[model samples]
Target: MLTYEEIMLLITALASVFSVIAVYYAIIEKNLVRAVVFSAIQSTIYAFIYYMFMAPDIVLVYIPVAVGLYPAVILILISKTEKVEKQ
Candidate 1:
C-alpha cells in the first residue's frame, strides 16, 4: 500500500509534468489568447499541487492571482495588443 505522503508525491509529480507541458505549449502557441489560456491552465495545475501540499491558504491566494487575475490582465492586455501572433 502506498503511504499517504507517497501518494501525494505521485500526484505532485504528475502535476509537475502537466504544468511543464502546459507551459511549453503556451510558449509555442501563436495565438495570444490561447497562450494566456494555457498559462491559466498551468496556474490551475499549480493550485492543485498547492492544495495537495495541504496549503489551502496558498491555494486561495494563488488561484486568484495566478489563475484568475493574472490571466484576465493578460487577456486585457492582449485585447489592446494583438489577438494572434503575426508570422
Candidate 2:
C-alpha cells in the first residue's frame, strides 16, 4: 500500500496533469461557452491542488476568484458576444 505522503504526491501530480489538459482544451475550444467551462475546470483543479498542499488562505481566495467569479464574469461576457469563434 502507498503511504500518505505518496498518495498525496500522486494526487497532486494527477491534478496538475489534468489541469494542463484543461488549459489546453480551454485555449483551443472554438465554442466560447465550452472554453469557459474548461477554464473553470482548470481553476477548480488548481484550487484542489492548493488545498492538498495545505494552503488554506490561497485556496480560499483562488476558489472565489479563479473558480467562481472569473468564470461567471467570462460567461456573462460571452453571452453578450458571439458564442463561437469566427476563425
Candidate 3:
C-alpha cells in the first residue's frame, strides 16, 4: 500500500493538474456552459485533495457549496444571458 504522504502528494498533484486544465479550458471555451462545467470539475478535484489530507469535514462542507451550489448558480446565470455569436 502507498504511504500516506505519497498518497497525499499524488492527490495534490492531480488537483494541480485539474486546476490548470480548468483554467485553460475556461480561457479557450467560448461557451458559458462549457466553462462552468470545467470549473465544476476543478472544484471536485480540489475536494478530493482536501479529503486526502484527512479533512473530511472540510470536504463535506465544500462539496455541496462548490460542486453543487456553484454550478447550479452558474447555470442559472448562463440561462438568463443572451447567446453570443461564435467567434
lDDT of 3 by residue, 3-84 (tens): 9888779879978887888879966888878888898988888888888778999999999999999999978987898444
Ranking by lDDT: 2, 1, 3
**Candidate 1: Cα lDDT at 18:** 96
How many residue pairs of model 2 clash at the backbone? Answer: 0
lDDT for residue 39 in candidate 3, whole number 0-100: 87
Of 2 and 3, the candidate ahead on lDDT is 2
Candidates in order have lDDT scores of: 0.93, 0.95, 0.85
Q: Which is the better candidate, 1 or 2, if ranked by lDDT?
A: 2
Instruction: Please give, for residues 1-87, the per-residue lDDT of candidate 1 as tens digits.
Output: 999899889989999999999999999999999999999999999999999988999998998899889999988999898798988
Instruction: Kindly report which residue pairs in candidate 2 clash with one another.
Output: none
TM-score for candidate 3, residues paired by index:
0.81
Off by over 4 Å in 3: 1-4, 85-87
> Whole-model lDDT, candidate 1?
0.93
Give the Cα-based TM-score of candidate 2 against the true structure: 0.93
Clashing pairs in 3: none
- Candidate topping TM-score: 2
